[model samples]
Target: MADRVLVTGGTGKTGRLVADGLVWRGIDARSATRRPFSADQVRFDWADDTTHDAALDGVSSVYLVAPTDRIDHLAAMRPFLERAVARVPGRLVLLSASSLDRNGPMMGEVHGWLDAHTSRWTVLRPSWFMQNLTTQHLPSILEDGCIYSATADGRVPFIDAADIAAVAVAALCDLVPPSGDHVLTGPEAMSYDEVASAITEVIGRPVRHCRLTTRELAARYTAFGLPEDYATTLALMDETIATGAEDRTTGEVERMTGRPATTLASFLTGQRAVLGSAGF
Candidate 1:
């Protein structure tokens, strides 16, 4: 049982990066995926209690990404987390969102539990990902040349998943860098409209921002096959944004990783080919 780190969402945006980062740092990184396709990956699913033991066995630390699409997921995750606390005996870094506070909502509740339960923990509350416009909203951008959101004119310091991973890797390595939740954000905040405009400039195509009501946005998420409650919660975050709730930025990324956070324009420029394919 060396100092190995178990990444729960090994195949996800940040999880893979965290795993790779750990490996690059000469750390033994174990990736936990539901379907194991590689020697480095162990089978793990939040719904399956049977898969928890093997995935957590002999691990020094865990980078937790809560079960997707399961709103109020603390109930399902507690059994495994309680086991992790006893079995792992190392850091437990959670990937929560910037909008969620300690004991506020889904992952927030998990945050509270970890604080009350253990001393070795760090909760990362990152702002919206810059990748969302390229992934989740890409279909609309390609088909209709538009980006959709309920946060009309709301600003967000959209962060790169890579930066989040960098911070997570640092947290796992340090074990106890800080005592409370770390709210990470990009260097600047901009609106979805600005995001669309940035894409337009990058791809030389007219991309518009389509504003929807919170209800409308929730419906759209459901259309994308998300559960109703989860979709509603996500859309409500947009409503929160509209009131300027997320109109701020923090230097957690740089402070943790010793690098400047990536900007939206730089990220979109890197994705120019993907974003411009349909336009051309």
Candidate 2:
């Protein structure tokens, strides 16, 4: 039998793409979700231990996507991970962020643990995703014709989720996947203004970037139903970007996937229809 890889958060943006890519490559891909959307998806919840064993069964490789329901996600996911390490062979690949260091919060702690325990593991630290503009930030963009942020003139090498998934599939399927941390980003760094201009060009609309204070941004997130602490932390990330923390690019994506990272213009072009229908 082919190696069966378990993908947590299978219904999510990146996880769904990863599962599809693995299946396309003729691998036995299993999606783990609390509510299985398809027959291929097994019931699994990071906060529930009862689902862990069945999800891990016959799974030689695992894709770990942390839960988003809580700010203290590491605590919620630790038990499942402990069980994974104890029960399964450790060919684990974790989805982390480029801004988060190994010792940082949430997945950062998991990165540290993966490095120390897993014999075969890869940590992907991708920068802000281009998909965020289409998904998470879409509602605001549609309603106000603007993209809101606190990063003043700071640039991010926004990567396409497809590119990230490509790299992830490579990692999960490779006989000897690259170990250690890999920082993934697009070919170039772009500011929010540039991002808005790109969207406007592709969609032929007047979408713009609306700059806000960190406090204002935090308030917006809170109004959107995030906890006060989480909202503040997210706003603080924008402040970090304003300090030029995320103003860089890397060739790791190209190196790993043997292709250059997807550009913002290209991504915008492909997503133009969706943006238009969403009130852009």
Candidate 3:
């Protein structure tokens, strides 16, 4: 029998792409989700302990993706991770963020724990996801014809999630696991204004980037009914951007995938509809 790899956030952006890539390469991939599906999926919920065993059963590799929306994610993952490493002797490729090392607080906590606990591990510290322009917050831009944010004169090397997934798949499948962390990024770093301009060019529409104060941005999110903590977290992330943390790119993607990472313009052109759709 072929070795099975368990994808924790199988339905997520990077997870879905990684799972599909594995399947395309003829690997027997298993998807773990809260709800069951027709595909080779296991009913797994991060909040539920009972679902852990079945998800880890016969799995040689696991893609650890944390649910970013939850603040208690580290606490929730600790026990589950303890169970996994104890039961399965395999690679644990954790999907983390760039610059969020063991010293960066929340994400850093998870990064630190996994670094110490798992014998065979790979940390994917990717820059800002390009999908944020299409799947998540792009609609607000398209709907209002403006991208609103708290990032002030901050340039981020926005990376493609697909590129991150590709690197992850390589790490997950290699016979000899690569030691240490891989900082992934796109071809170049670009600012929000530049990114917005590129999207406007591709979609042939006028989309503007609106800069807001952190407090004002948090207030806007709060008005949208997001919890105070989440709103504050969003505000903090935007503030972090202003510090030039995401202003660098790395050669890790090209090294792992045997190809250079996609540029924001290329990503935007391919996802023109998503970037231009108000209902997306």
Best by TM-score: 1
Clashes of each: 0, 0, 0
TM values, all candidates: 0.97, 0.96, 0.94
RMSD of each: 1.4, 1.6, 2.0
Off by over 4 Å in 2: 175-178, 278-280
* Error in Å for residue 152 of model 3: 1.1
The CA lDDT at 229 in model 2 is 87
Candidate 3: stretches off by over 4 Å = 175-177, 278-280
lDDT of 2 by residue, 1-280 (tens): 2388899989888999999999999988999998887779999988778899899998988999998866676788888888888876647889999988996887888888877776777889999999999898888778888999999899999999999899889888873354678899999999999999988888888889999999999999999999898899889999999999999999989899888999998898898898887644
lDDT of 1 by residue, 14-103 (tens): 999999999998898999998999999999998899999999878999999998868776897899999998998778999999999998
Global lDDT scores for all candidate models: 0.91, 0.87, 0.82
lDDT of 2: 0.87
Tens-digit per-residue lDDT, 20-119, candidate 3:
8888778878998899776699998878999999889899888889876676568878877898788767788888888677645566777778777766
lDDT of 1 at 277: 88
Pairs clashing within candidate 1: none
